[model samples]
Target chain A: AQTVTQSQPEMSVQEAETVTLSCTYDTSESDYYLFWYKQPPSRQMILVIRQEAYKQQNATENRFSVNFQKAAKSFSLKISDSQLGDAAMYFCAYTPGGSQGNLIFGKGTKLSVKP
Target chain B: NAGVTQTPKFRILKIGQSMTLQCTQDMNHNYMYWYRQDPGMGLKLIYYSVGAGITDKGEVPNGYNVSRSTTEDFPLRLELAAPSQTSVYFCASSYRGSNTGELFFGEGSRLTVL
Candidate 1:
């Protein structure tokens, strides 16, 4: 069984600053996918970014990027120039290749942005 | 586009009451999943379906049931509600061939069992 862990239960970032949310997972599968999902107070889950284990290069999407260290089983999310809208609960998830889309998720990290 | 839609955005039920959570997707995805999110806890998979007429259990399937009658709809049923079942339920769908494993989630349905 694969499990994701988000050590930080809560995080705070100042507006226009950067914050990094840490995540780690335990999985034996060589081919897998890692994802970060954001849930706002509105309760809508939105995709933030994703990383493929086979790819050594990190994935970047606008202000959201991931520092994926496959050997360490660590996948951390970085938010650059954070805005108030970035305040939300972020979750790290995992899904092995050919698993048919079943995902294992971490507890979550609640982020708050100060103006 | 309305990616995924879950009905009865909010509902409260008495103990032992029976109800169903309706989920529908417009993306015609091949895989659909039901998950429950408790306070301070991440979502836990309740059930999943690969396609029409094929269902499977997930991490936490007890006290719940599901059916995939069509590629676009997957409904979850609670035969007897309990206080432990009080949580926000989410319905999600994804294309089987999506390499990134992205899932489109519906606006969750919040349920309370009193």
Candidate 2:
């Protein structure tokens, strides 16, 4: 079984600043995928970014990026120039390669962006 | 695209009350999943279906049942609602493969079991 851990229960960032949400997972499989999802006040789960375990390079979206360290089993999400809209519940998820599309998610970190 | 839709956006049920939450997707995704999110907790998978006529239990499937009778519909049934079952339920769908395709989620259904 794979378990994902998000040590931070809540985080706050000033407007226009940056925030990093930490995530770690335990998986015996060599191949897998990591993902960060954001759930805003509307309660819609949106995909923030995704990183393939085999890729050495990190994944970056508009303002969201991931620091994926396969060897350390760490995948952290970085939000640059955070805005008030970035405030939400962020979750880190893991899915083993070849397994069904079932995701294992961390407890989650509630992000609060202060203006 | 109406990616994934869940009906009964909010519901309040008493103990032993039974209800069904409807979920439908239009993305033509082969994999559909049901998850529950409690306050301050991450989403936990309750059930999943690979395709029509095939379903499986997930981490927290004790009090819930699911049926995938068609490619686009996956309904979750709560036979006997309990206080422990109070949570926000989300329905998601994704393409089937190892690419780890992203999941498209519905707005969510908030259920309160009193």
Candidate 3:
């Protein structure tokens, strides 16, 4: 069984600053995928970024990026130039290749942005 | 387009009651999933379907049932409601060979068992 862990239960960042949320996973499969999802107060889950284990280069989408370290099974999400709209509960998820698209999610990190 | 839609955004049921949560998608995705999000916890997979007439269990499927009659709809049924079953349920779908493997989610259905 694969499990995802988000160590930080809560994180805070200033409006113009940056913040990093830590995530780690345990899986035996060599081929897998990682994702970061954001849930605002409106309760809508939005995709932030994703990373493929085979890719050495990390994934970046606008202000959201991931530091994917396959060897250590660590995948962290970095938010650059944070905005107030970024306040929400962020979840880290994992899915192995060739599966039925089932995702394993971590407890989540509640990120709050200060203006 | 309405990617995914879940009906009865909010519902409250008495103990031992039964209800079904309706989910529909417009993306023509072959795979659909049901997940429950407990307070302060991540979403847990309840059930999934690969395509029409095919369904499977996920991490947590107890007290729940699901059916996939068409590629566009997947409905979750709670046979007997319990307080422990109170949570926000989410319906999601995605293409089998999607490039990003991203799951498009519905707004969610909150159910409370009292």
- By DockQ, the best candidate is 2
Lowest summed lDDT window (length 10), candidate 1 chain B: B94-103
User: What would the per-residue lDDT of candidate 1 be over residues B1-29, giving only the tens digit for each residue?
Assistant: 88999999999999999999999999989
TM-score per candidate, in order? 0.97, 0.96, 0.97
User: Each model's fnat?
Assistant: 0.46, 0.56, 0.44
Q: How many angstroms is residue B69 displaced in model 1 relative to the true structure, after the best TM-score fit?
A: 1.1
Poorly placed runs, candidate 3 (over 4 Å):
B97-99
- lDDT by residue for model 3 over A1-115, one digit each (tens)? 7899999999999999999999999999998888999999888788889888899999999999989989899999999999999999999998888778568899999999999
A1-115 per-residue lDDT for model 2 (tens digits): 7899999999999999999999999999998888999989999999888898999999999999999988899999999999999999999998888767568889999999999
| Interface RMSD of candidate number 3 | 2.1
Model 2 scores a TM of 0.96
What's chain A's TM-score in each predicted model? 0.98, 0.97, 0.98
Residue A71 error, candidate 1, Å: 1.2
Over A8-71, each residue of candidate 1 has an lDDT whose tens digit, in order, gives 9999999999999999999999999999999999898898998989999999999999999999
Cα lDDT tens digits for candidate 2, B1-114: 688999999999999999999999998989999999998888998999889999998889999999998999999999999999999999999886424757899999999999
DockQ value for model 1 = 0.60
Worst lDDT 10-window in candidate 2 chain B: B94-103
Error of 2 at B11 (Å): 0.8
